[model samples]
Target: MKILVLRFSSIGDIVLTTPVVRAIKQQVPGAEVHFATKPGYRSLLEANPYVDKAHYLNSSLRELVQELRVEQFDFIVDLHNNLRTSLIKLQLGVKSAAFDKLNWQKWLLVNLKINTLPQVHIVDRYLAAAAPLGVHNDGQGLDYFIPAEAEVSLTTLPAAFQQGYVAFAIGAQHATKRLPVERIIELCALLRQPVVLLGGPEDAANGQLVEAHFSNRDAEKSQSRILNACGQYSLNQSASLVRQAQFVISHDTGLMHIAAAFQKEIYSVWGNTVPAFGMYPYRTKYHILEVPGLECRPCSKIGYEKCPRGHFKCMRDIQFEPFFPAAPAAAAPASQNRVG
Candidate 1:
């Protein structure tokens, strides 16, 4: 069978679909699995072995559809169940199944503060899209591949981080999803270990702020050295850094899921979004930190440029010491590569 699995964009959401891809390939006899995603994420799937072919959405959806028509997939698995996928299923005219996004459940949770959503992680829900095809979760968790050539060499990082470091992903898609710069600086003040700040070019300034704050505060101390690596490397290179770290601390974002793929213990900080959405770290040792029992918590199903309530207490009032007791090891060895 020739199957086309669709999850169009985002680092973390696409990564979450890997289990469905693996199940389709392993369980379906003679299955040739193809994945469709945005072009920027080509790197994420190119290195993956289970996906036999990859189709990237181009400038025109019609053109992308035409390209897929040639492959004539036997079925469709829509993990990203949105309007775009709906249109694709309509155009392809194929027998297909899609994951239920539970939009109403999310709406009730976000707007009414009512708890109606399931506790299942999004990965398991994504897998449900393939149930008709007899695909089952192998319980191995998510998949991420870093080609050997793309690996970030430890020698290339600052000498201070050569021994060990905590990889902290400091950026999220929305401002409200991340801690304010002041809060981040406050947390780093207590870490007392080598720290590598991780993010894209957009986060470079904030990463610099964190690094500069420490650089001036403790000019002579090497006990806690901070390196601002935002915008310095590609996504896979950043994943390489995450793989090599002793553990990872991240705002709710893509790197957090990447850390889970590596099975690195993760400390996931929360803001307006809560863990009940089931996007938390999957099948890995993890902790969730958020300001609990606030009436204004989960103000949005997604996030906002600023807090809707103007107080931002969901993130501002969060406590760290209780979630993070002992500091991570000063020299914990890096994890060995499990994916090619």
Candidate 2:
């Protein structure tokens, strides 16, 4: 059977769909799996072994649809479950199953603060999309693949990080989703071990601020311990860093999921959003840190540029000690190729 799986964008969301791809390939007989994602995210699936073909979503949906029509897939698994996927299912006119996004449950929680969400993780929900195909969750957890050539070498990083470091993801898609710069600086300062701040080009400034704060505070010390890697590495390269770290401390973002793929110990900090959404670290060692019992918590289903309440107590009131507890005396050697 020739099967088409669709999850359009985002690093974490796309990564969450890997189990479904693998299940259809392994469990079903003679299944040729093709994955369709955004143009920018093609690399995420191209290197994946389970996906037989990787189709890109071009600027025009009509153009993309035409491309998929020629392939003539036997089944469509719509993990995205948005309007775009709906249109694709209509156009393709094929037997399909789609993930239930639980939009109504999320709305009730976000609006009325009512607890109606299921206890299941989003991965399990995603796997449900493939149930009609007789596929089940293999319980192996999430997967992220980095080609040998794309892996970041130890030499590329500073000598301080070359030995060992805790990967600290300092940026999120929204301000309300991440801690303020001052709080991040404090969090980094409290960490006992060497630190590597992770983010994209957009987060370079915040990474710099954290580095500078550490520099000024520890100027009398000998070596430069904090390494700001924001904008310095590609997404895969950053994943390579996360793969090698002893453990990861991250805001609610893509890297947090990437860390889970590596099975690294993750300390996930939550802000306006709560863990009830079921997007927390999947099948990995992790901890959730958020202010409990706040009436204004979960102000939005997604996040905002700034806190609507203006207080931002959900993030500001959080303490760092709970997130990064005391570490062991001796550091283990860093893994050469931790990326899978």
Candidate 3:
């Protein structure tokens, strides 16, 4: 059977669909699995062995549609459940099943403060789309395959981090989801371990501020303890760093999901969003850090560039003690090192 799976964009959402990809490949006999994602996220799926072919929406949707029509796929699994995927399925005219997005439930939670959403994680719902093919979850968490060239060894980093370090992903798609600069500085100062900040080019300036703050506190120690890696590495290379970390401190962002993919102990800081939306880390050891019972919490389903409410207490009031434990006395290898 030739099966095509659709999850158009975003790093975390696409990464969450890996189980479905693997299940469809392993369970369905003679299955040739193809994944269609945006060109920017092509690398995420291309490295997976279970995926037989990788199709990217590089240009116009019409172009992608024409390209897909040639494959004559027997089935289409629409995990994105958006208008774009709908158009693709309508044109292809194949047997298709889409993951339920639970839009109404999310609306209720965000607008009316109703708790009608299901307890199931989004990964399980994605897996449901493959049920028609007799596929089942194998109990594996998530998949992220870093190419050999992208692998970042400890030796490449500073001497202090060579032993072990925390990967702090400080970037999120929206400002409200990230901790303010002062809070991040405080958080870093409190955690005694070496920290490597992870983010894209857009986060470079903010990363510099955090580095400066660390430097101002203690020049010699900050040099070894903090490394601003924003805009310095590619996505997969960043994944490599996350894959090797002792633990991860992250905002609700893509790297958090990547950390989950590697099954890293993730202490995820939540602001203007909550785990109730079902996008929390799947099957990984994690702790959600959020101010519970804030009326304005989850003000936006995704997030806002700035907090709609003036105080922004959701992010401002967060404390770090619960997420991070005390660091070791010296820069040494952590006792446990287990990764997928």
Candidate 4:
């Protein structure tokens, strides 16, 4: 069977679909699995061994539809329930099943604060869409593939970190989802062990700001401990760093999910959104750091450009102690590779 699985855009959401891809390949006899995602995310899927082919949506929908028509997939699994995927289903004229996005339930919860959504992780919901094809969740959590070449050499990072350090993802897509710079500085200051800050290019400026704040306190003392890797590494390269870390401290972002893919213990900080949305670090041991008992929590299903209610109490009031604990007397270096 030739199957085409579709999910478009974003690092975390695409990573969540790994189980579906794996199940299709392993359970379906003679299955040739092809995955379609946005052009920028091709590398993430390309490195995945279960996928037989990677198709990127770079141009017009009509153009892609024309191209895919030739391949003539036997089944279409739509993990992305957007209008674009609907259009593709219409055009392809193939039998397809889509994951329930729970749009109305999310809308009711976000707007009315009524809890009607099912208590299931988004990944499990995604796997459900494939039930008709006899695909089952493999219980392996998510998958993130880092190419061998992208691995960061121990020699490249600071000598202190080469031995071991905590990896902290310091950025999120929305301002409301990230911890304030001052809060991050305070948390890092308390972490006695060496640390590495992880994020994409969008986070470079904020990383610089944090580095400067740390530098000003005691240039020689603090500067050597915190390394800012934002903007300096590609997505996979950043994943390589996460793979090396003993544990990860992250905001609700793609790296948090990626760290889950690595089965690294994660301290996931919740801000504008709540884990109630069911996208928390899947199948990995994790601790959630969010200010409980706030009625205004989870103000949006998807985060806003800025806090909608303006108070932004969801993230501002977090207590960092529970998340960090005291650093061990003898900290071990992070792992460079996964051992089978």
In model 4, the clashing pairs are 163-333, 164-333, 164-334
lDDT of 3 by residue, 30-66 (tens): 9999999988997897689999998888769999999
Residues 1-340, candidate 1, lDDT per residue (tens digit)?
A: 9999999979999988988999999999999999998999998998999999999998999999999999998999998888898999899999899998999999998889999998788999999999999989899999999998999989998788998898999999999999999998987876867889999999999999999999998788764498999999899999999999988989889999999999988878999998889899888877777887889878887899998879999888987776544665332222311121
Better of 1 and 4 by TM-score: 1
Which 10 consecutive positions of candidate 3 have the poorest summed lDDT?
331-340
lDDT of 1: 0.88
lDDT of each: 0.88, 0.87, 0.87, 0.85
Alpha-carbon deviation at 56 in model 2, angstroms? 1.1
lDDT of 2 by residue, 8-32 (tens): 9788899888889999999999999
Residue runs of model 3 more than 4 Å from their true location after superposition:
220-222, 328-340
Per-candidate TM equals 0.95, 0.95, 0.94, 0.94
What tens-digit string does per-residue lDDT give for candidate 4 at 52-126? 998878878888898888889989999998999999989999999999999888888777888888889999999
**Residue pairs that clash (backbone atoms under 3 angstroms), model 2:** none
Error of 1 at 198 (Å): 0.3
Off by over 4 Å in 1: 222-224, 329-340
The local distance difference test score of model 2 is: 0.87
| Candidate 3 residue pairs that clash | none
On a 0 to 1 TM-score scale, where does candidate 2 land against the true structure?
Answer: 0.95
